[model samples]
Target: MTVIDLVAQADGADPLETEPLYHAIDPDLLDSLPDADGFSRLEFSYQGYTVSVTDGTDGVEISLAETGVSVDGSSGDLIDTEFST
Candidate 1:
């Protein structure tokens, strides 16, 4: 999923090598949220990042919260988390 992809990207590793997204949130619930009438956003922590998914008229936007540590155990900084699909 996007969270795993982003985390893997930040770590400079293959997405498959990253932790499973389901470990941080319910994948099935997340997949079904767009169909929920009033659903707009969801946030959860994966690895060392806080993942935020916002639903809008344009599309779903994914972002990561700034943290003090990264997946590689270094200082964390915000990456390009503002993307829609």
Candidate 2:
């Protein structure tokens, strides 16, 4: 949900109006993944961008592929919040 929300935010679209998340990945499998020691991570494409979910350590994180700018799911704050022209 956090992942979808942030991507929608970046795209200036409503979360509900954006592409369905399940079309890119399985929500159940995502939820079932372990979050121990920050080793568990999942990367998939959604809404034309690569979405990465990293659990544990610093909580859930979602980033735009290799953009370096990432959203911290727990805080809803952008990390490395910069964009190149």
Candidate 3:
């Protein structure tokens, strides 16, 4: 999935109806992904989710607001911690 599709899934909205990706990253940033030489990655928060795009990958990853939960998981905190410091 493209970054835009992941953002749409994260927001529970239509891809076209969601905020344009241009609002989050420069349009050219995406255009350059195809020519990555090494481990190129882009990260940004949009529509309440943390988005991660890695070069040479066909999928876009989305996580919930960086609150210790992944979008596709249906469980408690994935990180085990009793204290927040």
**Each candidate's lDDT (Cα)?**
0.74, 0.62, 0.55
Could you give candidate 3's per-residue lDDT for residues 1-85 as a string of tens digits? 3666655665568888877777777868666666756646676755445555655345433333443544455444534222110
Q: What lDDT score is found at residue 4 in candidate 1? A: 74
Best by lDDT: 1
Backbone clash count for every predicted candidate, in the order shown: 0, 0, 0
Instruction: State, as a TM-score between 0 and 1, how close model 2 is to the true structure.
Output: 0.63
**TM-scores, all models, native as reference:** 0.74, 0.63, 0.55
Ranking of predictions according to lDDT: 1, 2, 3
Misplaced by over 4 Å in model 3 are 56-85
Residue 9's lDDT within candidate 1 is 76
lDDT of 3: 0.55
Error of 3 at 73 (Å): 24
Clashing residue pairs found in predicted model 2:
none
TM-score of 1: 0.74
As for lDDT, the candidate ahead, 1 or 2, is: 1
Q: Per-residue lDDT of 4-30 in model 1, one digit per residue for the tens?
A: 777777668899988887778889887
